[model samples]
Target: MKPRRKSVPVRVGNVVIGGAAEIVVQSMTKADTRDVKATLNEIARLKDANCRIVRVAVPTREAAVAMVEIKKASPLPIIADIHYDAPLALMALEAGVDGLRLNPGNIKDPEKVKEITRRAKEREVPIRIGVNAGSLPGRPKEGAGVRPPTEEVVAAMVNAALGHIHILESLDFNLIKVSMKASDPPTMIAANRAIADQISYPLHLGVTEAGPPRTGAVKSAVGIGVLLEEGIGDTIRVSLAGDSVDEVEVAYGIVNALAEKLTGPNLIACPMCGRLEIDMLPMVAEVEKALKKIKRPINVSVMGCVVNGPGEGQHADIGIAGGKKEDEQKLAS
Candidate 1:
């Protein structure tokens, strides 16, 4: 991987983002934030799945009030996701949330943003200027095509982030992170690259509303993996519409696939072809299950045929290949 983008480090609870810290993996809880029990339960599962940071949506007054209890019980650092309502952000900071995510799209008042920044600065809590393509600050320009030029979209996202960054920086409050997410990968990649060129604040990467697990993982992998390979992102989240734990798993998968710093065992399996000589699917599944207990990074390959087995599995730390017969299998060392 290319050297990571140089970013000012921001601490969220115990986890440090940017500056020489490992690419952090994070996910948002899907449960209603008002249901403290359910939210806590989801966080426990996310922690088990190796999520380093967790974001909880504080959309309602009750939810904002519940932040106190959830933050108290959450094992991972809790970041309150705020939109529209500035008081909700205040409520979260007062409840001792580790961090805050303010959507510039909906919460347009500069005075309110400054108020939250003052309180967050006093508490030393970091805030993420989370800009989403779907919720940009203004309506599309007149006489625009079906899709605006990529440059226009990219500029919009970056400018939105910079606007928020300006508000926080004005108060000498530099505990900041930024995210420019879009449901589409191209826009997300372009926006992040643009912002990365202009700012030193840590960036949280994701392809927002990236559909179900299968498709979302692919979209996130493409968008996040491309940036990570270029060393453009400081942290990442895979926004799958499924279980929150799957988001953590997919986030790690994207990181592991692109970067050398793996969080868990990396499983390499070949797509079964007609040349296959053994039932490698079951074996791959079994190996994946066994690798879950491992905490360290290792490459383990399971190939289904001899044609590419020797060549493909040769570099892996451990590998298994099917032989001519079902009972015969060879281990590559």
Candidate 2:
């Protein structure tokens, strides 16, 4: 493997991001953060699924107040997502959360921002300066509107990020991470690249408000996948609007794909062209269903005709292929 680029590792609890550590996977809890029991249950599920860090919305006072119990029960470290109100930031920190997410586009007050930074320093908690092109402010009326050019969008996000950065730096609080997100693939990719060039902070990567399972995965995988390959993101989140567990699953899949070793099951099947052999479809289907329930990273393959199937599936740890007489043969290579 090639060497990692110039980057400092940021510690989220015991897990490390960047600097020779295995990429860390994080997911946000959708349960109302105020509902501690529900939130804890969700967090526990994510933890069992190997989630390294968990983020939760601190939208209201009840949610912010519940951070203490959530933090106590969480198997992984907690990040409080404080949007507009800076007071929630203090509440989360006081509750002993491991980190804070302060969105510059949403946090409008300077004094409240300063106090949040100061208190974060006192509490020794890390802050994530999150930005999304969707939430970018002050775009001119007649221009591209929500879809500003990647460079323009990056500048806006970086400026707001730096503003919050300066406050934290002034108070000598250095545990900072930044993210610049957009719904469109190209915009999301370019904004993150531009921001990485400007700041040395670890980056959190994602495409916000990505739609359903199929399209959302493709968008996130393309945008974020490109960045990770270029050695960009430090921490990543797959912001699927649906099941939070799916988000965790997708994030890990991307990481696994990035790794040199193919850990999980690898599906290799022929398109069932003219050379197809006896009952290849059912054979391949059986292999897939068998491996679907696997939790550990294990590799398997399925193919159609014996001619191409065996050779192609040879790269896999365990594989199955169609054979004569309505039967199939399995291979290990």
Candidate 3:
């Protein structure tokens, strides 16, 4: 079994983050935060999709005000994503948010961040410091207005996070989460690694602007997946620029992709060779589709014929071998 990295445990409402807790899965709401009914409806959809935590943008006073009702109606804890306006962050906190997120570097004004941290510490709300390649102070300076290399992106994020942490630390606040998101896979991967080396605060892993579902899901899985494999991240977001429910589904997949070490089921299949007689493609797809409904911790195998079938895949907790149907029934059973 792989070891999880050492990280501080940060709680978001009742959910425990970092430090051996199952990686928390989160997705942002697509509905405008000002639209209480619509945002509530969308978060219901995300919750059904298994989103562990939900973040909504608090870009306006109306949204910050709406957060009171939204938080009232929400079944899960709400994390308000605030940028540029520390007042909005302050208002949302008063509106009864469970957690807060802000890019302190972008907040620009020092006094506001200090006050935000003071209020947050009072409420016991954990803060997530989001640092993006597009918003980093030195992103342009580091790469001459082009995309920065991995180390620079990491440096800027850690610097930004540490900057915020310093203010919060001075305010005697300790609960925090941090993320450094990039659209590129390698930069995202490298940035997490670099930050992980320097900070023990829980890390939220994500690749922002990762396109449409199929393409974005692949990129998110690879980047977040690789980081999680290294035991580097605590919470994860699949930032698909689409339905937030899909983001939740992809987030769960990324976290549990390697979870077969203890929980859930894993499927293994063999590609058919010359021994292929039956059209097994549809059969494999059918079984895989059905297996999604199985929450049990078991291993399932679907293999081709005698050549590539049974020998290697027999270790599955359960299995099926494809061949002449009548002869193979007992073997698969």
User: RMSD of each candidate?
Assistant: 2.0, 2.6, 3.1
lDDT of 2 by residue, 130-177 (tens): 887767677422365544556666677778778878877887778888
Cα lDDT computed for each candidate against the true fold: 0.89, 0.79, 0.81
Q: Is candidate 1 or candidate 2 better by lDDT?
A: 1
Among residues 3 or more apart in sequence or in different chains, the pairs in candidate 3 whose N, CA or C atoms overlap within 3 Å are none
Ranking by TM-score: 1, 2, 3
Query: What are the clash counts of all predictions, listed in order?
Result: 0, 0, 0
Over the stretch 1-333, how does candidate 3's per-residue lDDT look in tens digits? Answer: 157788889989889999879888888998988889999999888776667899999999988999999999998889999989889999999988989998856896778888888899888999998878778776745445666566766777768777877877887788988898888788888878887877888999999999999999999988899988887888899998788878976776666567646345566777777787667788789877886666566677777776756764566666667777631432333
TM-score of each: 0.94, 0.90, 0.86
Better of 2 and 3 by lDDT: 3
* Deviating ranges (above 4 Å) for candidate 2: 1-3, 140-146, 263-296, 326-331
Candidate 3 lDDT score at position 161? 73
Query: Between which residue pairs do clashes occur in model 2?
Result: none
lDDT of 1 by residue, 197-231 (tens): 89999999999999999999999999999999898
Against the true structure, whose TM-score is highest? 1
